[model samples]
Target: MPSDSDLVTVPARARTSTTTRVAKVLGLLVLAGLVISFPSLAPDSFILSVGVVIASYAVLATSWNFVGGFTGYISLGHAAYSGLGGYGTALLITRADVNPWLAMVAAGVLVAAFAVPVGIASLRVRGASFVIVSIALVLILLLVFQSWGSFTGGSNGIRLPRPFGDDVLRPEQHERFFYLHAALLAVLLLCWWAIDRSRFGMGLKAIREDEDKAQSLGVPTFTYKLVVFVISAFFTALGGGMYALWFGFLDPIFQFSILVGSYMVLMSLLGGIRSLFGPLLGAVIVGYAMEFFKAQYGDTQAHLIAMGALLAIVVLFMPDGIIPALRGLVNRFRPQAASIREVSAAELAEQRRAAEDTGGSERGEKEEVRR
Candidate 1:
């Protein structure tokens, strides 16, 4: 039979876990409610349009997190997958005469299938080499699409027929796509939440901490990285396809721009890549700032400069990102979760003496029983 202390402690721990879970569920519900009500609350169509873009960025950032956040791969050309997804969807709709919605799904599947070989090759490298390979992928795709004038329209690019039809007003389209992007973000978040608590997530974190050590411990490091890489590509492609459908345009240069990939990286790093909502939080901040700068500065590179400054600030100060930094601050101030105090040599000695005395008493009691 267990001790009374054991019964008490176990129930306390269980109750803590349960309370944490309930709080998380309630928080998610509140967030979902806010997301659902965003368009209705927007002051204008332009604001609604910005909301759509923010939601889209949130989806892309979270998708990127599947690899970069979990496996610590830090891909610099995730735009390659998104570009491929957009082109695939466009081609399927134009050349194959598929329905736009169906084209998006088909494009996602095709892009995911393509990701397998790409992931296998990319996962062979690590660190800067992996980053270089990822960047090369987007560059290669960009040139390939650009040079294939007849098929891809070269620099001319291609335009998509809006999936929602011409009957929908621009503001209405923005509202609908905002919801669509939010739904996708919600799904990605749920998937990430599940993964974050699973054995697979543990393996990914092990890889992130030390890939060689993880492999030595039989974690199948390469396999785990590749799986996450592919999964990341899949969702990224879906986001790209959705964006293409909404925007009704696909310029290979813009679609595959290394800048887009950098945005995803920055967003994740800004918000706390390790946490479930880190990327989403980052997306909202980065996306709005980017859009705001662009709107205020016209076609100038002010947004780029702002982003660079933001990146520097994040790196220099909050290296752990906003969420973790805020968490640290909160923990610091919490009375019940007070910071641990250092013990002096005297204190250590006293603890040791107490433990030894307790052990001696236990032995004496046992001996007395034996007698």
Candidate 2:
């Protein structure tokens, strides 16, 4: 017969598992409903535009997390890939008259192709050296695009034809782009969740913990990092392409700016880089704050000042980011629950021996009675 403790623990374990599943399902449903209804609920075109920006940043931050968060590589040059995607989409649409949607996807493929060699070379380095390489990549792209005025429009920037043309009103334009960005964010989140539960994500986490140890365990650390880097570049590029379409403009200075890269890093770090939804939360906070600052202060340095202050506060008070900090608080204050204990090998062996003895005694008694 099972012990009293065993009976209690089993039911507790079952309840915990069931509770987790239900919570996840309900959370997903709530998120889906909010995203789908956001445009209609938005107060005005300006608010909707802000929503679009938040969604864009969310996508970029989430994409960055795949490599920076999961693989523990601090890549500050992701803006280069984003710029490449923007430029690729803009050039194709303006020069070749390709459909905007097709251009966006093709731009992602092009950026991924570009990432292959870069990842192979950069992934070999670690720490500061890798960071420098990443920064250099963005700088180089910025200069190249800035100088190639004939093809890239140089410092004057490239003006893109609107994806939906003049037929769409300003309000409708905001609504459409907001939904488009939301959809992209959904896709990226789905991909992140899928990878987070897979063996590949486990390998990435192993690399994050200790690359040498992971390599010794035959994790193929380089391949995994490179693959994830490429994937990150692809999605980030897509976000850039969409942004270019929405704004109908692309400037190398802004597109490939180190500031843009910093924002991505900041959003991820502020939200809890290790958590799946950390980047999204970070993006919402940072993105909306940015828009608010710009609206209040205009083109001055006020937004930058606010961002710096926010970063300092996060670093000082919530080093693990808001999500992780909040999670810790919840765990700390939540009521204690029963937990199942792990079985030891020695205990298992003893139980087996006892079962064998009981079986033998029963058999002997049966034989004796029969005789």
Model 1: lDDT to the true structure:
0.87
RMSD of each: 6.4, 6.5
Worst 10 residues of 1 by lDDT: 1-10
Clashes of each: 0, 0
Candidate 2, residues 1-371, lDDT tens digits: the string is 44423323233445867997999799889988998899999998889999999999999999999998888888988899888999999999998899999999999999999999998888886767778889999999999999999999999999998889799998899899988998898899889989889999999999999999999999988899999999999999999999999999988889999888878988999999999899999999999989888888898978778878887787688867888888778767755533443545665555556656665576678789989
lDDT of 2: 0.88
What TM-score does each of the candidates earn? 0.87, 0.87
Clashing pairs in 2: none
Pick the TM-score winner: 2
